[model samples]
Target: MATNVAMDKKPARQTVPNAIFSLDVVKEKERYDLWRESIACIFEVDGDRALRRTSDFKAHVDANMFGPIMLARTWTQQQDWKRSPSIMARDGMDHYMIQLFEHGQMQWEDGTGLRELPKGGLIVFDLAQAVKTRTNDFCNLSLIIPRTMMDGALKPQFDQHLRVLAKGEPMVKLLRDHMLSLKSVSDRMSVRQAIEVAPATVGLAAACLNAAVDRENPHQGAGIALAQLTVIRRFIEANLSEPALSVDWIARHAGASRTKLYKLFDAFGGVGTYIRDRRLRRALLALVDETAQYRPIYDIALASGYTSDAAFSRAFRAKYGIAPRDIRGNQARLVDIGLPTDDKVDRRYERWLHHLSV
Candidate 1:
């Protein structure tokens, strides 16, 4: 005389590495304070008394990280933002930020001088430098990328900070559309897919920057090497899966000499090492992706240009100190380097910024 019973079980929720902060959810009295604290990592923010009032405070942000790059769409009331020498020394980040204002206006002063950013203007900021800005109630999209990722794309002394491009230019429009497209589809992209897309996005950004520089100064020959290296890097990213992706093939295709190509990547360990590192990293991501669990290890190895399973295993172990299958589905979560351990403080955005690395 046993009775049958049904068991109640709920599926575990999937976690995505994204942040959305809206002032509407915060208590009225704490909204402005929370907003200022949330952005403390990148900017010291404050507003006029009227905008800072409990009843008047308003801000919203949606941010997503794709490997070494981050894209954010933000809306806020009038505020002042500053990045001083102390803040730069404390944070120790030298990343590049490309911001596009969709509405409202802003006036900023940096080492270059004071400038105004009107609606539909795109500007670049170098985080290593000092700057201050006062803005009208505004909405904007920001793309933040590490300087390491721009290695071959931008010259070290380019002085591109505060460089603005208006929406009227065809190249600017294309660049804006590309960044927006990535944002729109980011939610559906897996960690592996996002990592793969980062390089291409950087390439488009470099193209826009180089075009701007060429138009501004035709006599500047300093960027020739930068442009050549950019082409080589983009070619490497596009053909990482090909087994024949070698220095000779890349040199021929990218119009660079073998010696020049080798020299260009010398700082990053030679050209061969760069290709091997990128391929191994891609394979590692694919192996850890839960959505790609059904894919065979051999298939992943082949895609990474390793035809032999043993070779792939040996190379993977040598690089990561673990077998390819050891941490497959067990470690599907995104790894955040240098994230804060204290949970009592709400620094989610700061954690995300810290997690960004090359």
Candidate 2:
């Protein structure tokens, strides 16, 4: 029999927000020139920076739903490129800027400290700050989002760590991927999609900021730490049957060092103890599985990573105040034993079976 199935090729129509700009064109040098012209125009009209024609530059501006974020590469022959004092006056309008160096080095006085933003590093500054950034020849990415949009996502405590060089993280990779995807399908996104995308973008931005900042509220930070801990614990539970699952393995899977992994588990108990407890608990559950009625206690222990029946029995007795044999015996007698017949008993048994399968 031959079957024909039609597949839809067009995207679904949704209420999409207006897109500001997309990096559609890739004229590298021309893009940079455009950025320089725009900056020069701003400086000329507002008299913010002491506009110096000391460097040849190139930039590309990719507009988002709210505003434009630019990737700029520029060279400077002189060291006098600085922002004018009048620039600080206009900064009250609340313009935010983040500069990440792709190559070369740059220096700036960030009021609190003289920050040196090296290659692969980032610096964030408010237009209102009396700060001046200087570089001989630097290539960088600059992101400019509305201040109102940023205010909603970032906590006031993270203000100091606003500009951060991203270390390797899944969230960072996700944002980079999303940016690339946005560039590809800029015109396809509907107005509603654009609006929805903004919140997702903010969530990623907030995560990045959270990674960079040291929170004043230790309690709130602890909650985030606990959530991450839960993820690690869940991973441990899923792979308990694998004999090779050790502390090092768990650390590698959790994207944390062995020491950090141990510390995270130490809040409940030591990692070694936790692993043993979890294995024993899983073995106990498997012993009660009604579908596995024919399986021996030794087989259940072995499946849960215990090598010897004697060793497994000793641990099981220590944990549950009874030997594995007694536990299995009790489970087997559940059908034969006379007990009170109630709706509660039936519901509890059904729930237990469902949990065992899970």
Best by lDDT: 1
lDDT of 1 at 108: 78
Model 1 scores a C-alpha lDDT of: 0.74
Model 2 stretches astray by more than 4 angstroms: 1-37, 40-85, 102-105, 110-114, 136-139, 169-191, 215-358
Alpha-carbon local distance difference test for all models: 0.74, 0.50
300-345: candidate 2 lDDT, tens digit per residue: 8888887888988998888666776776556433322111122211
Clashes of each: 0, 11
C-alpha displacement of 357 in model 1, angstroms?
Answer: 1.3
Worst 10 residues of 1 by lDDT: 332-341
Instruction: List where candidate 1 sits over 4 angstroms from the true fold.
Output: 1-16, 110-114, 215-347
lDDT of 1 by residue, 1-358 (tens): 1233223444544333687777776678888976786677778898888767758688888888887888988899888999875555345465789998878889976445787985676898877556888998888889988867887786444666677887787778888998888888888887778878889999888788767664454323434554455557667867888888998998778778999987777755678887888788678767866699889999999999888899999988887667887756334222221122333334466656644763
Q: Which has the greatest TM-score? A: 1
- TM-score for every candidate vs. truth? 0.60, 0.39
